[model samples]
Target chain A: MARVATGDAFTSTQRAEIDRAIRDAETVSRLEFSVYVGRSDGETRPFAQRLHAALAAPARSVLIVVDPPARIVEVVTGGEARRVLDDEEVKLAILAMQSAFAAGDLAGGVVRGVQQLAEHARKPQLRHTD
Target chain B: MAPFHALLILFLLPAGLFLVITLLVYLPSMRHSEGYQPGQVWRGEPEWFGGPRKGVEAIDETEPAAVGSGRDGGESGRGGASGHW
Candidate 1:
């Protein structure tokens, strides 16, 4: 397969893999998932929050921000998303990603982290509506 | 040994072996050159996947305080975690 080189943090194939992971996560959790791979303007936490706030529907969104140069990874869950994914759950995902990043697998870390988050936030199945 | 045999043993064999060894050692590193390494300066532009295409630009222009203010509602429902490698 030909690798498409883009002037971006990830190669085209890597981006597509992340996109698919996000899509699957969204499908499972019924929440929007966005990934930002780049340097933050200031503190990574606040920058991630702002990006989360900018989403079309902040209440149902999850934003993952990764700053490779700074070695920072932040996950921000909006109003509604926070309900299903608490701080503890997010922390678990963060740890998983941190280990992967430590080994220089940026795209792989993001994909795994997103998938883990979605699994944790998966909507409860309705047994009966009667 | 004949001239042809000596040439094959000393020149052709070593040249072939060197070429093979060089390729084996160099190709894998080239394939992995794009991966991010800790402490390496990042040169790529920022990218947002699954984010609002246009709204994100505007967020960067607004005062950081205003964005922070969004956290003030009584619910303060936003939650997440951060980490470093």
Candidate 2:
């Protein structure tokens, strides 16, 4: 079997759920979404930002970095991504995730964060635009 | 050969065997005996480090250029925030 992620971080079932949530979030926001669950080698924020920059399209991607042992959660938005997912919206997602992690619900926290970000970033359908 | 040499060798043989057995079996089990251990933090190396990846790619420290890494193929600015639980 392909061990895509660290086994202990999430079981196969849980990983599938989280992956689905990420895909759904991407669809809603029309942005790239990536999630990383591992220990942070350095400062969590900088490490997350580094990870964000390395993505294929940094400007339109949303990167979520979770350092479980450190109990840290960071939501990074690319340039274009930030326009739709504003700072406050990102903070709200972080807050939600933090609570979930505090309660030892890693998968739940990620799913909730992804949903919240996607919700905040979703473009409202214009009923009438001449 | 000294008279006490045989006795010393006999004592050392058992002692060495016991040490080898302890190292081979006992220590590792005790070190990781806990029910579950969460994954370690990112340290530039993981089991799948050099292997081909799909979807999300881990950060490469030396290479700043976004070659085939990102999904969107756009430049990213540092615009996100962080929080601790």
Candidate 3:
């Protein structure tokens, strides 16, 4: 039997689920998605933006940062990504995640939030474009 | 019936049943307890999933560049939302 690492924030199974959610979101959105689960260095928003800025392709990426202890969640979107995912849409996803977090479902909240963002940001099908 | 056989069935049956019931009651809770709860401070290092190659270490050293320098100017182009539980 594989020994569970008690020090980890998420178990192996939860990690797998989060990974799957990211993968699916990328496939749907054609945008990179990153999730950070831990403490914020300072103000949560700036920490999240810094993390987003560090992405290889920040202009096409979305970063979700969740600080459980601080009860803060921030979603930072890049230029191209922001075109598709407005603040209103991102706020809706945050609300979904916040409710889940309040219930102590950290992994589930992340997964759901990622999926929701991707769903909202999915490129509208280019139908009948000459 | 043999004395050992009777004792084995009578004693082991209830013991096994009790063990099964206990496991059934506790298994879900054990799974749920794995992750951090609200307002719980995390002792583990921060984790970034599907992040840049340098991972969490890069963020501290690298200042946020002019991200989203598109039609929208400065940070205004970089849109997102913040929340708390």
RMSD of each: 8.9, 14.0, 6.9
User: Which parts of model 2 are misplaced by more than 4 Å?
Assistant: A1-7, A128-130, B1-58, B61-77
Ranking by DockQ: 3, 1, 2
List, residue by residue over A10-123, the lDDT tens digit for candidate 1.
766788899999999999999999999888998888788888877788778999999887899999888789889988999999999999999878999999999999999997
Compared with the true structure, what per-residue lDDT tens digits does model 3 show for residues B1-85? Answer: 9998898899988899999999998786576547654445567578899997788788766644553343234654787889989
Which candidate comes out best when scored by TM-score? 3
The sequence of per-residue lDDT tens digits that candidate 2 reaches over residues A16-130 is: 7778888898888898888887677688776676776666777788888887667788887887898888889999999999888877677788889988999999998879857
Cα lDDT, model 2, residue A89: 90
Q: Write the per-residue lDDT of candidate 1 for residues B3-67, one digit (tens) a residue.
A: 99999999999999999999998876456546555555677778889988684595766555535
Assess candidate 3 and give its TM-score to the true structure.
0.77
Q: Would you estimate the TM-scores of all the predictions?
A: 0.76, 0.66, 0.77
User: Model 1, residue A44: displacement in angstroms?
Assistant: 1.1
Better of 1 and 3 by lDDT: 3
Which regions in candidate 3 have their CA more than 4 angstroms from the true location?
A1-6, B1-33, B61-64, B67-76
Docking class of 1: acceptable
Residue B24, candidate 1: C-alpha displacement in angstroms: 25
Tens digits of per-residue lDDT for model 2, B1-85: 6758876678877898889998988675454322213353323221211112642344554266643233233444447778998
- Candidate 2 residue-pair clash tally: 13
